[model samples]
Structures are given as C-alpha cells and as structure tokens.
Target chain A: MSLQRLAIAACLLPGLVACVNSTVDQMVFNTPGAGIGDASVVILGRRHASDYETEPEFIRCVGNHISSRDKSIGVVGEQEFLDALYPWFEPRTAPLRPADLERLLEHRDVARAFTTMQTRYMIWIDGSTVRNDSAGSMTCGIGPGGAGCFGFGTWSNDANYEATIWDFSKRAEVGRISTTASGQSYMPAVVVPIPIIAPVQGTACDSIGDQLLEFLSAEY
Target chain B: MSGSMTIGPDRWLAATLLVFLLAGCGTKQVLVQSEFPPPVMNKLPLTIGVWYDEEFANHEFFDEAAGRAETSWLVNTGQAQVQLWDTLLKGMFRDVVYMNGKPGPGQMNPVVDAVLLPAVDELQYAIPAHTNVKVYEIWMRYRLQLVTTGGAPIADWTMPAYGKTPTAFMQSDEGAVRLAAIVALRDAGAHFASTFTSIPDVAQWLASLPRAGDAARRRVQP
Candidate 1:
C-alpha cells in the first residue's frame, strides 16, 4: 500500500474502533403537553430484595444533572426523599404498579408529607450496569519500592436502565425513558499496565437525565 | 447446471403464504361474558361498601411476542365478582356502594355499616404445547376481607376456583381460554354467595346488627 493510503487508514482506524467500542441506545416517551413548571421532582432508585438503597453515585449524578439543566424546578435530594418516605418503605419495590401509588397516597400522612415536600412528580430508576464477556488476564508483582503489573486484559461492560415518570396530581404515568449502554475497556502494558475504565453508569445516567428533562419540558 | 438458479412464481407464492401463516399465529384478545343469576334479598338490612385492590381490578395478561394484551382477568374476576356480590346481597342489604378506587379519610359513605375488600391473589391459564386435543385450564384465587368503617377487620377468607374445557374444532385457543375463565369465575361467585351467610362468624356478625324493629324505633324517635 502507498504511504498516503496507509496514513489515511491509520487516521480512520481509531474512529472506527472507537465507534465499535461504545454504544448508547435510548427510547423516550414524551407527553406532548406535560411541563415540569415549579413543582419539585424526586429521583429514586426503586428498592430491590438485595439492596435497600439505590446507588449513591447514580442518584447524586442524576440529581445534579437534572438540577443543573432545569432551573425552574427543584430537585429533591436523596436524603430528604428517603427520610420523608421511610415510613412507606415496606411496599416500595421494583415494577411498582399504578395501584401501589394509589394505595400509598390513600394514607393521609403520606399525602401530607409529600405535599409538604412540594413533590409533584416522581422518577423511578431501575436496573444496573455490570461487567461481562471478560477476556485475557493480568498479574501484578510488588517490589520493595513499588508495585507494577505487566500483562494485557480486556473486558466489556453493559448498562441497562429504565426511568419511569409519574405525575402525582394526575395519578398516572406520564412518560418513560429506557437506555442501554455497552462498551469495552482495555489494559495493555510493557512494564506497567494502564487500565481504561468504561463509564457505563455515567453514560446511562446522563442519557436518562437528559431525556427526562426533555420529556418533562415538552409542551404537551 | 446451478439447479434452477432462476426464481419461479411458485417459490414466491410459497414464501408469501408462509409469512401470512406466521403472522396469523399472533396472540388475540378474547372477551368473556357470563349470565349472572338474578339478585336475591339478604337476611340482614345493613348497607355495605365494596373496595377492590387497584392492581387486581385492572390486571391484564400481555403476550410479549404479539405486543398486545391477550387476556383481561379483571373483566371476569374483578368486575364480575363485584356485580355478583351486589346481586346476591341485594334484598338482604340496605344498599351496596362500589368504591372504584382508594378512598381518602371521610370519603367513604357514612351510611354504610361495613366495607368489603376483594383482592385477586392468583390467576393463570395453561395449555400444553404439541397437544392435539387442545385442552385449556384456568385457575383463580381471591382473598375477601370484611372490615368495619373504623378499619377493624371482621372476617377474611381465601377462595380458589378452577375450570377446564376442550377446544372445539375451528375454535381459537383464545376463545377456549376465555370460556374456561368464565366458567371458573361463575363457579367461584356461586360458591362464595352460597356459603357467605352460612359461615359461623359471618352469620354471627350479621345477627349482631340492629334489628328492623330497633332501627324503625330509632328513626321514629329521631
């Protein structure tokens, strides 16, 4: 091959490789006339049987993103939401049906607490990100002065998440956003291996948060 | 010779027919209707309020492959049960109030003496694959609770009902399932109504209510 052709190939290869390494798939259900207005929105990670609290990092990231993007609405902090909703924790679970909310709101105390918090909308985030399809291996040796690893390793990560928005005033689900992110990470070393981390959770949070803002802000 | 490399009209026709057949196999919604028995008068004249669990009241089974709701058990199990209860207890009770959704404090009718809450516990239908006979079976379980207006539970019971039917020639699987579900719901309603007033605790509670003579006296005095 000519030097020019090889140079062009070298330039294009990284772009192609990068594209193959990362993927983001998103679906948004926007309510045409729904607006967030001045109501407060709370983002919660639906509790599962294994975990009592949602990932702190994910909650904080989403809260920060939403608060930063939309200045008109107030974002309820994780601690405040948890503290207010602690009394009704037993019935809060994944795949919450519409009836569950109705039942919960039937309690005067619950309604009063939520009203006091000025929370009119709830965003329920569920699902997780995990490492998968790991290949290759690495080993490290420690010397008196320091420690160093000399090996190559590669792994893929997948993030699957869904966010459901519920309007308390309407007593119905207004919209939903589902996102999937997958990427590969690599570590190569001649003497010391530098690891590349796949920001799967961060990507998922960003995608979901941005779409949520769009759905909430749409003039439907 | 490349063994008839040119496509023929017959091959294209065969492919189109296969596609149509596959598409026709998608799930279909089935509506089930039943003829309920006429209303009967209750022995007791106390008014009752009926409340249904939201999930159970609007429950539907989805066929993911077809991307549609295939069956609505709520039709037969939730609405039907409420209707039957109203009918069977009509004469014996003063009035029956149907609370469609959760009621807040002071939202309930003050005239009603007690409330009846029904929740669907389990609902399922099964049909074995690769079966020539084409038999469908349906099962339903309901939990019934009777409570006072003050939220004091009076009585509760769980009832299970089942029905099975064979698919007729040229009949759809969805139709067979619907028929089976109807049969199960009918049997469940009948059994519940028949034995409701006979239960020792329930009968005792009914007997404790104000008698017609006493009620008339109180009204007259007031």
Candidate 2:
C-alpha cells in the first residue's frame, strides 16, 4: 500500500507543475516584456457592460475576455457620449490642454496606474455619430442601392477603435494603436476583441500591441 | 465657441482671438498659457523634420475598409500633418528652459540657434533666415493627393463634380494636403519649463543618444 501511494504521488506532481507553468506562460505570452508579475490592463471606451438587445455577441465575448486573463481590465466612460454607450462604463476624461494631444497625454493618471503593481494601458474607442444624407452624414439604414443608410430616428454609428498606449514614467507615447473596418452600413462593421493577435498585413491589433510590448520591454 | 482678444503695439490692428472650427473634425488647438509678449521684433522659425527613427517613408492613410487605417490616418492627418508641425517643433526649442521661471533672455520668435541648426542638413530647415522683420520665412513641404472621380480630361472642367460652378470638393482636404502655413510667435512659457531642461545643440546630438530630451533641455536656456 505504501509503494502504491508513492507511485500515485509521483504521477500527480508533473500535472501540477504543468498547470503552474501554463499559467505563467500565458501571462508572459499575453505581454511579452511586461515587467513580469500581474499587469493591470484597463480598457477605456464608451461601452462597458454587455447589452443583449444591441450587442449580444459582443457582450458574451467581453465576458470571455475577462475570464481568460488573470489580470484586471476596467472600463471608464464619463464623457457625455461615453456615458450613453455602456451599462457599467465609468466615465473619465482628463483635463485636456489646448496645446496638442502630446501635451494632453502629460496629464497624470491618463495612462499609467501608479498605485497598483501593474501598469495602466488605455484604449480609446471613437464615439458613434448619426447619419443624415441632407447634411452630408452617413445614412442609418439600407439604401436603394443596397448600401447602408441612417434615418433621423436611428442612433449614430460608432467610430473606429483607436488604442494609444503611454508610459507614465516616460510621459511620452510608448505605443499608439488604432482600428477600423468597412462594410455597407453597420452590417459591414465588426468589433474584434482586444489584444487582436493577427500577424497579417491588415486588421492586426494584437500584433500592434505585441510589437509595442516588445519595444517597451527591450533594454535600451 | 468663438472668442478674441486685442493685443499689440498697434492695439487696433491686434485682433487676437480663437474660434473652434468644428468638433471631432480630427483637429484641435489648445492654449499652453496666457501671457502677452513685449512686441514682435521677429517671428519664430518652426523646424519640421521626420526624425530618423520615425517611419515617414512607408506612411499610409486610414483606409475605411482596413482596421489599421486609423493608426495611419491619425498619424498622417495628425497635428504634425499640418504645416504647423514644424513650427511647433521649433517653438518647443524657443522661449522656456527647463525649471526656469522666465522665458529665454533673447528674442523669443527667432532663436539664433534654430536658424543655424537647419543649415547642417538638407532634410533640416532649407530656407535661409528671412531678411524682412514682419514676414517670417515659411519653408514648407507636405504630402498630398488630388483625388477625382473617373472622367475625361478637360482644361476648364474635367470632372463631373466640377460642374459649371466650383464646389467644396474641388478644394479637397485629402490626406494631409496643403498642411498650411502661419507666421506667429507661440510660447508655452515658464509653466512648461519643469518638464524640460534647455534646447541643447541640435546637430551634435545623434538620434541614438538616450535621455536626449534631458540633454536638449539642459542646453535650451541661454
């Protein structure tokens, strides 16, 4: 009985080690040069919580995103336009200066989270705009040519995803990333999950993030 | 919101004002600080250049269909896209030094050092110092495109969009087209000094040097 017990213990140890190694690997894999340990990932956008009526699949995908990673990713949306988009989105906009966007990035806490062990990464999704043909705006619904059109009653469509990463310590643009897609009206529009890892020529948000992480991690 | 203030030796001529053209039109302007200058002896020279590290050649625009278009479009039509990108680059070197409470002692507009630095390379500022006092040298080069609907060649009106009457489409704001030019002395002033040292030697410092911002700041103040 004692010999049998020892054999079982030896068999289980490797599996446990593999689990531990896998967790660490995933963390390191997600962020190539992220200063090791847990890094806080903050997703700032107009939408936060999932909406079944409007974006059911998106809502489901967000839940899957949160569960996949051990790090925390919070959403903020205090601006007038942002408040209306997400259910749990917390609205936040820095005191923007008149000089330039570079100056605007200098505002403390705009990108970096100093208190936590993790660093702060911000993603800004552009706000949606209404479509009106008379004033030269995009249409809300379908057109006679089978193209997308927007009427007065419909809400404005969302802007492309433009993610800009900043290092609080450096106080300069460490990484800036943006995303956009085209199709007829909103039908053609699609929002991919964050940390898009495609290595293709186009539609590669993950690759952009990966490259930025690599640069930040590189020893100068 | 539109607002203006009068400033200058000839107060009547000075219509210093700011007006917001449009919101979310992919353009913005902000006040660094509020302070008046003595008088305009000369306008500051704006230095514009694509640093060796920056990817200027393979530059691309935002394709409505492409996901990566936003990154290209923003950088392309960015603040640097305008003629003023050079001006602001030069302006950063002008008045304030790091941690100093006052603007540089010499003329703020036309810094002698900026006028001299561009002479080192063709990619640097090409124009010689202007002879006139009021008119500043506006040396500008920008990437642009003339997009038109498919049509026959017409000396007078080649495109259908250009009917008998001229329209706004004729004056396209296509990707960084005509970035623009302006002659004015702008200073972020002493408040911004804490973040910078002094504008150091422009030519000597290679792009490879680390903490170059610190080096530049140390040399900026006279």
How accurate locally is residue B177 in candidate 1, as Cα lDDT from 0 to 100?
A: 79
Candidate 1 docking class? incorrect
Tens-digit lDDT track for model 1 on B1-222?
A: 456567787688688879988666555565565545532222345677777666665555543442232322222344555555555556335677766444445565454677888777877776534343345767778788887765677788887876555544476767777766765665565456445666566666766766653452232200
- TM-scores for every predicted model: 0.44, 0.22
Off by over 4 Å in 1: A1-34, A49-54, A90-95, A144-146, A218-220, B1-222
Off by over 4 Å in 2: A1-36, A46-114, A127-159, A185-220, B1-222
- The positional error of residue B3 in candidate 1, measured at the CA in angstroms, is 99
Top-DockQ candidate index:
2
Q: Which model scores highest in TM-score?
A: 1
Share of native interface contacts recovered by each model: 0.00, 0.00
Error of 1 at A72 (Å): 2.1
> Each candidate's lDDT (Cα)?
0.62, 0.26
